[model samples]
Target chain A: MNLIIGNDITIGYEGEPVVSHLTFSVESGDYICIVGENGSGKSTFVKSVLGLIPPLSGKIVFSGGLRQDSIGYLPQRSAIQQDFPSSVTEIVLSGCLNRHHRLFGYSREEKARCRTMLERLGIAGLSSLSFQELSGGQQQRVLLARAMMATERLLLLDEPATGLDPQATAELYSMIDSLNGSGITVMMVTHDIHPALNAAGKILHFSHDGYFFGPKDEYFKSEKGMTFMKEAGHDHH
Target chain B: MIITEILSYPFLSRALFVGFLISISSSLLGVSLVLRRYSMIGDGLSHVGFGALGIASLLSLSPLYVTLPVVVVSAFLLLRLSQRKGGGDSAIALLSSSALAIGVAAVSIGGVNTDLNAFLFGSILSVSRSDALISLAVSLVTLSAYLVFYHQIYATTFDPAFAKATGLRCERYNNLLALLTALVIVVGMRMLGSMLISSLLIFPSLSAMKVARTYFRVSVIAAAESVAAFLAGFIASYALSLPTGASIVIAHMLIFIILSASGLIIRRIHSVIS
Candidate 1:
């Protein structure tokens, strides 16, 4: 099931183009990691896919016939304020803000779904805790839980393990692997390649100059991939 | 006591009602401003309102008519300039400083026989029926706008990129929030005086955030706190024959300190228990 297709996509800010002539198709249940340098348009590509930035020129087709509500997005946790004074439950409940509900408030079923998603993510105990008080790893889990409350088909994560410790990173990736195994498509943008590259089936290498779309095995086999990794001082496993 | 005399007067009742209405609008708008990190913009816009008031008094026009449009237009310009990629904070600071300077100049230069004390410290006794009606109308409009666009505001405030990706028009709503903030400042100036209005905008909301876990609860508590502060300040001012605006601001600060201390204590206890 093809969930997203971008043909000849070009994205950038008002004056300059960041990434151009990019083409890719993501299927349901496919776990893809995008790797690039700091200014390499990885986040831009993700944002473009999510319709945050209008492509300079291209067509993005959502072939699975999924509505906007079916898309779950976990943005960079650092981008949000930790001391925002919202409970884990309240933050998670915001994922359902777009859903149809009664005139009064969220239905009991919605509340149950929120609780279930938190429990499924193994953070049910943090439900009543202030979101700001959670550890970085715990905060990411709560955000993931919130995203799950919105959709089960596709999860878009922007650097889910950027600030986590080694142990936490391993745990987070394992969780992601399990989620992918359960048939949820995951697209993540990250600057660090080792962890995500090992976990992702497909690696999308991006740069301000261009991008390469291929499987992980083929990526390491290419000359450009070797040169790119060598220049960044990262050895391939 | 002076408090007993003020409490027994219908004029004092009217003043308290006006204060309450302005506080509600300020607290609600304050949440959006704080989240956007434009908390200082409240102070800036209030200063602009002061200039508008001076202009209005000089021209013998109703201060509300002159100040409302001036402050709203200033807010619009502020939003417009801030939307440019790297211009947000600088633009707000520039506008605020210029507005304050111009306001001070206008008040001094106009040499209008208007009572400067009433303009600076607030003269609740001078709050006419028409001013009350205007305050009520502004409150209704601001509240209705908030209720209607609550989801959009929440989305944009939490994650602008996500909100944009999800097909929500963030710029429009962001500007609308700014416009509402301007309206609240203009309306609140009559109660708190332009110099002190921004305190009413920020203090209660900050205090509420110290304790409330959800945005909804924070807003509710903020509104309640603002009303309480207004009542206490009004009574204190009457009792001590102090300046009403200063008294109200002091009351709000006192509440914020008390609430913040209690919140700290509760958090320590929770950590220990957990």
Candidate 2:
């Protein structure tokens, strides 16, 4: 399945559009990374794609038999209140609420799926622990497990490594790489570009004015990309 | 001795039944209010409800019937006004204050001679059979709605963006919460009084969070705390001849302080052990 975008798209509140005239497409098994500076509409673009924010113009068409239930979203780790009183198991089981299991109950298959996802994410032992008591990296891993509970077809991530240490970031990236290797389409929005570039086949670069979408190699060769790299004080070797 | 006398009186039996029903409903709604950080909205809505009661009394209408619709409409209006950007707190403040002022003015202008003390301070003896029935009905309806929309409510509360992405109508759930809050406020006012009803909604939930590890646990703890406070306040009011509302609020506050202190101590012990 693939997500297709065509023509000019505007996203923001009632006054002014944050990102305008954006067009892109993502086929199955594409590891796409969205990079830009703060307030460059990176999160806004991701939110718009997920239908969290309504687009002012243009259209987003999901082709290749992409079902809404199969899409998994991992929001920015900071966006959720860590102090929220819920267990790791409860949070992961929430992802299965859309599957029409039973009224006010999770199915046996759903419970097994949650356990399997937690085990895959190396958090099976933390299922009974309060989510608020977890370390930052562990919490992120738990949230990622929660996101992966329903399906493995498509994953959307927003700044998955913002609060993690370098080692933790490396570990998370490795998990992301493995998920991508399993043929899950991964789209991520992040300010940090290097780690993302290593795994992403395509780059969606956003700026104050507009954005560019194409192969990551071609983006690195472009003048704007080179200017962005230089201004960011990074040597893209 | 006071407990013995309270149990002997039929009026006190009615009062306890009313208190129990209202506490259960308030604690359930309190979970959502505390999570949304709008716990104080309960206080604001109760003050508005007091105004509605005063107007009903002045018009020689049944206060229960008049206040129910008035509080429900006010709750709806509060939700609508707060949804507008930059108007949430201000709108709540405006509605609460205006309702209070209008209620006092109406009572004064009508030269009402009814004992308004019970409405403000609450008196267990003042609870009637009709009020008890109303409270029971409200509790049942609220609990039923909670069961029916538990998933939608959970999805909306934890993550609005994901809820919308998954095509859940979050706005409808928000309105349902507001309506439920209104029903709880109107029914709880008889036992808790308008001035102190918010304390019943906030304190138990705050106390529950100190030890509970999950939302379900929090709900259980909060309900237990609320019931305990109700019984304690009822007994204390009977013994000391104090206002029911003040006694209940004081009981809740005392529990909140004790729980908060214990939570801190437990955290320290855990850290030391680790």
Candidate 3:
């Protein structure tokens, strides 16, 4: 079943299209990797899907029990987060800020769920620690746990491995792969041509010249995908 | 000793009460403001307050009547500007410096020099009964507003983009925060005065952050620190015949130094033990 459909979308700011003539759909349990250079509108497309910015033209519909805000999103690391003083548990609990409950306090069940998410992410022991004190991989996992508290169906990650070491990057990708195996749809924007090009069942490649979106096998054969793979320093036959 | 000395003089009592309230409100708002790196907004808005008061005095109208709307609007404008990337600090500096210039012009033209010292540095004896009442009301409102919106404020400060993606009206909560900060600054101007008021917002939060690892604890400690500083400073002002705002700011500075020293000691001990 299709969870999201982008119908002939043209996205950018101030009515100037950055990457236009785009159309895509995300089906349930499918992993879609968005690959492109910087300024390729990949981030812009993520914002549009997250409803941070409206598309210049065309409709992107969220269906199949998905609201626009219900998707779990792990945003890129920000400078403000580097030294921010917050406990891990509170960060996870913020994921449920929009949940239907009392305005002031989280319900016991919600608290329990957050605890479980932390445990599942293997960071329950670190829940009491301040966020900025954690290592890069640990922080990313904590954020993933927070995003997990938000939704169980879809996850959107933007360059989740930007600043990680090789081992940590492998760990994060494997964690994401396991999540996809458990029936959650993932749409990740990444510069990781290898994992992104291999693990993702579909590819949505944005470019300054144009864009491409299709199944991975077809993308392996397409002209734009071939050029992208070549330019990204990887050749797949 | 402090309580006895303060209540002996009604004006001192009034100054302490109002100063205490302003301290609490400013510190409470200071947590999110500091976390978001919007601490300078308080400084900026207070400058706007001075400019607006200048206008009010120039036209011989009530200062509160003019300062409230003008500062609040300026608060919203700064919030809007800060949302955009690049030059946010420069923009704030530009606006605030311009407001200060206008304030100087207006004050000079209006010839309110007789009241200038009280307006700039704050005077315990100059706070009227009406000003005390306004401070009380604004303080209560600011306190309750922070309480009610605490969760939203937390999420927004931590990450507004993520908060927005989760269906929060980030702009609305941000506006609410800005409005409260503006209200606090305008009322705090009565006691801390515009020149010293932003210190109330900065010192307490930074000091609390030195010792606390969590947002809730940081804000709570900030409020306690602010009130304690104001209490001690107010009493000291009466005892030593010092400037109220200067004394209170000194108190904050001293506490911040003590906390920083303690925080450093605790960290060193923890590392040694580990």
Candidate 4:
């Protein structure tokens, strides 16, 4: 089933229309990798999808029982987070804030689920430790656990592997890949192509040339995709 | 002995009472403010309140009635300015200086009889019964708001993007924080003065962060530390014949230095042990 459908969507800054009139649909349990250059309206597009920013034109419809708040999201780390004073458990528990209805604090049920989530992500022991004390990889894993607490059905990660070492990056990709295997739809934005291509079922590449959205093999066949791939390949080599 | 002296003097009793109440909310709200780098909003709002006080005294109205709404509106405006990308410092500077100019002008023109120095530097020793009552009321409201919306505030402070994605109206919480801050600053400016009240918001929170790893501990420690400092300073101000606000700020500075030293020592110990 199509969890999200966008028809003739135009995302841009200051009403200039950079990535204009691109129609796409994301299916349930499908993994989509969004590859783009720095200024290709990717962040703006993602914010529009999250309802943080409205699209210049057209609308994003969330069907198949998916609410906007129900989609778990892992935003790229900001400078404010680097030295932020917070414990791992506190951060993970904050992810369940959407489900929390009563006032005061988290419920006992939510606490248990977060504990289970930390154990699943293999960071239960670190839950008591401060976020600032963790390594880059451990911090990403903790964030993934936090994101998962928001929703089990869909995860939207924006450059989740920005600063991790190769080993940590690989583990994060596999962690996400396994989560996708468990029937959660995964949409990730990344600059890393080969690793993303390995895990993603579909590719949405945004470039100065144009925007291309299709299955992985079809994306390779597309004009912009082929050009981006060659350029990315050369850069990496 | 100190208790006996405090009971005998209305001024000392009022100062201690109001100062403690203001410290609780100031330190609690300070945690969020300092972490989010909005500490200067306290400074800005107090200046706006000082300006409003100038106007209130000129018009023969109560200072709280005038300063409260004006400072609160300025807070909301500051919050709006901060949300617009970056450069919060400029906006705060522009507004605070302009308001301060207006305050000085107003006070000089019509209300020279009112001591402008007291408003700028605070006079904890001059706290009135009415001022203490207002401080008590506002402190209770601010503290209760913090309690009711504790988790929401935590999520918003820690990760606003994730919080916004979770259908939390971060603006409402942010505005609530601003409103609470304005209330506390206005009530606080009565005794701590516009110049020194921001120290109450900044010192305890930063000091607590040195020792506490978690946000919860940071908050608890900041409150306890702020109240303790205020108590010590209040008594010390009386015993030594020093300015109450200055003594309290010095007390905070002393505690901050001690905690930072202790944190460095603890980290060194860990490095050696490990």
Candidate 5:
């Protein structure tokens, strides 16, 4: 079933269109990789999908019983976000901040879920430690755990591996792949698309000329996909 | 001790009571502001308070009535400016200098030089009974506001974009925070004065951060540290006949230095043991 559908959308800032004429749908358990160069509106498109920014023209409908704020988001890490003075547990547990209607403290079940998320992310031992003291790989894992606490269905990740080492990148991609295998839909935007390209069932490639969105198998045969692969020196079967 | 005799007086007792409340409120709000790199907003808003106080003195009106709304509006303006791209530190500097200029002009033109020292540096003896009551009431309100919105404040201060994506109204919470900060700064100005009030917000949070790792502990420790520093400063000022604001600021500085030194010593010892 289609979880989200974006029809004829134009993502931009301050009413000036950056990338226009886009259409896509995310089905359940499908992994979509949005690939593009800098200033290609990949981030803008993701922001629109997440409802962080309003689209200039088209409508994004979230069907299949998804609420407005139900999508989990793992934004790119900046220096200020990295230096946040919070514990791993506090950071992860805050994912449930808007999940409830009440304004009081978290329930016992919510606390239990946080523990489960930390354990699932394999950072259970680091729950009490400061988030900033962790390595890049650990921090990303903690963030993933936090996002997981928000929603178990769909996740929107914007360049989740921007400043990581090769090994850390591999580990993060593997984690994402495993999550996709467990029936969660993922829409990730990244410039480094080679290693994670295999996991994506669909590709949304934004370019200076225009944009393309389709199944991965068809993308492999499309002219734009072929050009993108050749330019990035990435081989896809 | 002379401190015992000093505390017997109603004015000194009122000063201490109001000072304690301001210290607590400022430190509680300070942690989130410092982490968000918006610490300078406190200083900027205090300057706005100075300007409002000048106008109030010229009109012979209640300073709190004029200063509260002016500072609160300025806080919101600063918040709006900070949200815009490329309007961070420079905006703060511009607002602060303009307010200071307006305040200086108001004082000179109105010829309120007799009360200039009190407005700039603060005099505890000059605090009227009604002003103390206002301070207490506002401080309580600020404290309650922080307590009720602690979770939202935590999420927004850490990562506002993520918080907004999760359906939390981060901007509203930010505005609420700014409003509370304005209240605290205005009340604190009565004791800490305009020139030295932001120190109450900055010093405690920075000192607490040097030792604590978690946000909750940092806020709690900051409040304790601020209250202690204020008491020490007030007592020292009375004993030595020093300027109240300067003395309080100096005490806060000394405490910060001591905390930093202790933190360094502990780290060194741990390194040696390892």
Candidate 6:
């Protein structure tokens, strides 16, 4: 079943469209990798999908029992965000904000779930530690745990591995791949195409030149995809 | 004992009661304001209240009634303006300076016989019974609001964008925070004054952060520090005949210095042990 369907979506800032005519649909249990070059409206499009920004035009239908509030989101962290004064446990528990009907307190079950998620991320012992004092990789894992607390169905990520070493990036991708394997639909925006494309079942490549939405194998054979692969290969070289 | 003798006076009791209330309210909201980088809003809104007080005094109107609405409105305006295309500092500067200018102008033009210096610097000893009651009410309201929306405020303070994305009405929480700050700052102006009230919202949180790692711990420590500092400062002000506001600020500074040094020593010890 299709969980989300975006039809002719135009997203941007201040009524000026950055990415126009974006049409895509995500099925349940599908991993969709949203790939784009810098400044190609990927972040803006993701924000619009998350309802953080209003779409210029078109409809985003959350069908198949998916509500906007039920989608977990992990935003790309800025330097200031990383240094925010909070404990690892506090940061993780904040993700449960959406799960509560009341405005204030969390339940015992929520606390237990947060701890379980932290344990899943292998950071339960760091729960009492300061969030700002953690290593970059650990911080990302903690954020992923936070995102997990928000939704059990669909998880959206915006460049989760932007500032990490190769080893950390690999570890994060593996964790995400495992998450997708566990039947949660995943949509991620990434500049890093290799591991993302490898794990993703579908690709939504945004480019000024064109938009490509299809299976990963078909994307790899497409003209734009070949160009992207060649460019990535050259950069690595 | 000196403490028992001091507590026997109505004026001292009123001052202590009002001071303790202001300290808790100030430090409660202080963590969010400081973390969200809206710390200056306290200072800015206090200036607006000061200006309103000056006008009220000149017009023979009650300062509380006049300053309360004016400061609250100014806080809303500042919050809205902060969302627009400008640095928050500029908006704060524009409103605060203008309010200060209007206050000074009103006081000078009306030739009010009141001590403007006391209003600016505060006279904790001058707290009346009615003023203490108002402070208590505002402080209770502020603390209740903080407790009720504690988790929401935590999420918003740490990551407003993500909070918004998660379908949380972050703007509503932000406005609630602003309203609470306005109330606290206005009530606090009677004790800490316009110039020093923001220190009540800043120093406690900062000092607490040096030793406490979590937001909850930081808040707890900050409220404790603020009340402790206010108590010590109040007694010292009476003993030395110093300005109550300055004395309280000094007490907070001294505590902050001690905590900072202790944090450094603890870090060094941990390094050596490891």
Could you report the Cα RMSD, in angstroms, for every candidate shown?
2.8, 2.1, 1.9, 2.0, 1.8, 1.8
Candidate 3, residues A6-109: lDDT per residue as tens digits? 98889998888987979999999999999888898998999999999899999899999999988798999863368778999989998987674685678899
Backbone clashes in model 6, listed as residue pairs: none
lDDT of 3 at A191: 86
Q: Tens digits of per-residue lDDT for model 6 on A115-204?
A: 899988889999999998888889999888988898878999888888889998999999999989999999998888776557999988
Q: Rate the local accuracy (lDDT) of all candidates.
A: 0.80, 0.80, 0.87, 0.87, 0.87, 0.87
lDDT tens digits, residue span B19-128, model 5 = 98999999999999988878888889999998898888888888999999999999999988777787587888888989888888888889969677788888887678
Top candidate on DockQ is 6
lDDT score at residue B8, model 5, on the 0-100 scale? 90
Q: Give the lDDT of residue A163 in candidate 2.
A: 89
Which candidate comes out best when scored by TM-score? Answer: 6
DockQ for each of the predicted structures, in order?
Answer: 0.45, 0.56, 0.63, 0.69, 0.65, 0.69
lDDT of 6 at B70: 97
CA lDDT, candidate 3, residue B226:
97
Q: Between candidates 2 and 4, which one is better according to lDDT?
A: 4
lDDT of 2 by residue, B166-257 (tens): 56677888889888989999888876778888887888888999988787788789989999998998788878888888998899989989
Worst 10 residues of 6 chain B by lDDT: B80-89
Q: Model 5 off-target regions past 4 Å?
A: A101-103, A235-237, B1-3, B270-274
lDDT of 3 by residue, B31-115 (tens): 8998888888999998888888878889998888899999999999999888779839889999998998898788899886966
Cα displacement (Å) at residue B261, model 1: 3.1
Off by over 4 Å in 4: A234-237, B111-114
Model 6 spans > 4 angstroms off: A102-104, A234-237
